[model samples]
Target: MSTIDIIGLDGYENAYPRELSGGMRQRVGFARALAVEPEILCMDEPFSALDVLTAENLRSELLRLWQAGDVPTTAVLIVTHGIEEAVSLADRVVILGGDPGHVRTTLPINLPHPRNRKSALFQQITDLVYTILSEKDYEVSPDDIAVLNQGMYATFQPAPASDSFQQAASLSQRKPKSSRSEPFEAFETARPTNLDISEEWAPNQDSPLRYPQLPAVRIGSVTGLLSFIAEDDVDLYVLGQRLQLDVDDLYPLIEAANILGLIELNEGDARISAKGQRFVGASIDERKHMIRIAALSAPEARLVAQIYRLLSQAAKQELPEDLIFDTILLKHFSPLKARKQLDIAIEWGRYAELFGYEAPTGTLFLDRGDEPAE
Candidate 1:
């Protein structure tokens, strides 16, 4: 009772989870977790789905409880994409880099509690963390920059698009690395421009059945993003600034474009690829074909494409929705991400004319009634 009350669900004890709002349900989750009063609490991107104010309120309450010694947990471990959130909460910030992800560096945040986000020191720390996350873990040699200057990144593009593929990663699996890092002057000197950073960022093989997530974007937005890159290259940080979004938020869009060979990421810049050049000019039908081929081709987005294919082939191009949720999406994505991936697949696949679903029948088929016109 104390746990539930502390977590802000004072009168909702008898309420079913379905009756609660998303944020309320999240609070309920915290209440349940705290009921046992475990020694350590581990949270993975816990606030990612919440609205900004709700997430802020929740974090504030959690901090209040911890500061006042109201909770029994000795330590809270949180994995998040929000840098400011990390800095505001974590005492030690561990930066993860490279595919198969490893800690590249650990920087201690020695700031006093109840940190000020607008302060000069806070901005400085955030900048340092940004540079750390952006940099390749390995030292860059001048010789490497010299080679990359000769247009080596062009080769980073995937094999020519195919009409069909059994595995997306097999056909679309490309090794992507481009060079450049703006060094944080606080701890490092200026970095060389035009580097071959292939070793830094590459697709994971997911050897032991690891699942890749679909970008939290729709197909329509991707077209606009591609068009922006096609017009002229743009730095990722610059884009983030313009959009008032975190740098991490932009990576998914970049990855989606990279998976489809619609754009190439170099250093912090996103430049259009040859396929992207064609995509901008392609007709509606041709565009869908391009996307379909790319989906069945790349390692990153390939799994989602494959899942869509499985759903399509099941029951001769028609299957129950339960089959999609229980057998397909859930198998690949975590429970939290499975429904999102389904929504993503539905919206994205429709743009590619990929597949369709019937709600009442709980069937997967090739119907495009709601597909947007070009």
Candidate 2:
């Protein structure tokens, strides 16, 4: 109880929840839980409501108590929506799938205690978790996925074999010092042309009309990610693992890039498309213009246009974000899907300068300052 630092708080022992600050109240809750001396401690986003410093302090204190065995609890399970928090705290992270939840993967945290954020090893582990979470339900052959060691390089094989071994050190020796840190060099020899993915799950490569459900990625990020893929012919899973973005964070970028004809997804592998190359090489104005044109062609953009027209015809130039959220989006999609689509819509409008969002008011309107592409 004293170790959590609530003991020194003035008159905290007698203070009710209403009397204490949010952080103090949280600490009291922690102390109360610890007082019982239970064998296992399970916390559901304990420090979520606290400020940054308070959360940090609590995380550190909790780790100390867990490591020192100062309390009766031997094991602690934390449920957090924050990926970085999970990576920072857990020895093994069990990723759960949606709906009827089931374990997707259990990743072991091998980084040392009090992990350094700047270290390559720590980044590798973080990226690995992101890769796991970003995975899609599409059927992927084990061979199509590039398996790296300790978040470094390895040959991507379509099938398992003993002879297909390459050392990162040896690969690094052959490269110039400047390129040594580049991850995909080891897989250069194993790079295959468009590994076969099932047609059902693969995006409509032939049709320009159909678009995948894209993540709400900004134009800048979309271009940067496309450029990286152009330079490195990496697998989607491998790329996400390297970038350290889970499905929630990664897939949207992939979908957006793909939709904009900025990248190509063949099997599980992602490569930059010709248009993406041009966009990457173009100036910011050129890139924005291209994205604006691309956005005009997308289904989401059409919906935004429709809403804008409807509002304008009704003698209103603006509409509440929630109005669109509840009426059109939620009507057509599930609550969760609707929320994601709304996010994507807002991002699209802003990036193309097609619409403006007043976040304070949660309203969307025509972006008069954002001139249309001439």
Candidate 3:
């Protein structure tokens, strides 16, 4: 008599045979077979009596145990009637033909775990196997033959939208390098001649411009103001220098925020609006999501910043200066468009007073504190 427990059933030793369900009785038979610590375990339609879900569960449990290396180094072989179940559970599938059950074909499945039935490769293999089975010289009804023929082409194809990543990458790579270069010239020409400290900094109350939607500038400005308010008005020039943006780019964002009742901008200094303060209080993920949504909605420097944020997040770090060109290419934007977008973000930063250039190292920093007007 077998002494080993099946499916962790050692505690049920005294249970009456009549009390167990068919599945439990099947498990008992399995336990008895395992008792002698056989070097090999063969399951011959052991799951046939169980429901589909129970059979699948048992198959998974068996595979897990086999992988755990706890059971005495035993090789397992399972026989099943369902083709999908056979494919799922077997390392190799063997089909029998002829009246005496002679082996007709053997197929090796080398797919990795967590296989997707909907993949092209899975369908291909299933079709190939069905074709092999259909070639046997047995008489079959026309309906059965038609069903087998359809199984040969059963496959899933994803919608066109699923190809965005590839399309985006291809589009970015094809853009000319010269298109990206002209924007920097525009930025260089746009820098302020005299730092106008006395200009009445009324909040630009206009609805954000639609086309040439430049949201990054606004976001940078708001970020700068938030940093400034959080750190105490430090130095204006230092803040500008830190954010690597021109004053022009910085001003509009702050102005936009003021329009939206999100911040207060005054004489080269900015403080958060009540809404802005609440925005800052949101979780980091929420803030990023909001920034992305807002950037998508309007023409502001924030859009450019959102793109940079996406690239940075995807790359898992700040992009190197030299690689920025290549990164733009990967985004599917023409080099010109990418350069325009990036320059827009940088310029907007400068305008919003969120960024400034370091004369010594030339590195941009997120200058939160206020700087005295240069």
Q: Highest TM-score among the candidates is held by which one? A: 1
Off by over 4 Å in 2: 1-213, 246-248, 300-302, 308-316, 335-337
- For residues 91-173, could you state the per-residue lDDT of candidate 1 as single tens digits? 77887776787777776666554455555565766766776677776443455334323332222232222100000122122
Per-residue error for 327 in candidate 2, Å, reads: 4.2
lDDT of 3 by residue, 71-152 (tens): 5646887777666666555667787887887987667665443334545555665666676677885444555345444434
Count steric clashes of candidate 3.
Answer: 47
C-alpha positional error of residue 119 in candidate 3 after TM-score superposition, expressed in Å: 3.5
C-alpha RMSD of candidate 1: 21.7
Between prediction 1 and prediction 3, the one with superior lDDT is 1
lDDT of each: 0.57, 0.54, 0.45
Q: How high a TM-score does candidate 3 get?
A: 0.35
Which segments of model 3 are wrong by more than 4 Å? 1-6, 137-374
Residue 124, candidate 2: Cα error in Å is: 24
Distance from true location, Cα of 303 in model 3, Å: 59
Candidates ranked by lDDT, best first? 1, 2, 3
| TM-score (C-alpha) between model 1 and the true structure | 0.42
CA error at residue 283 for candidate 2, angstroms: 1.9
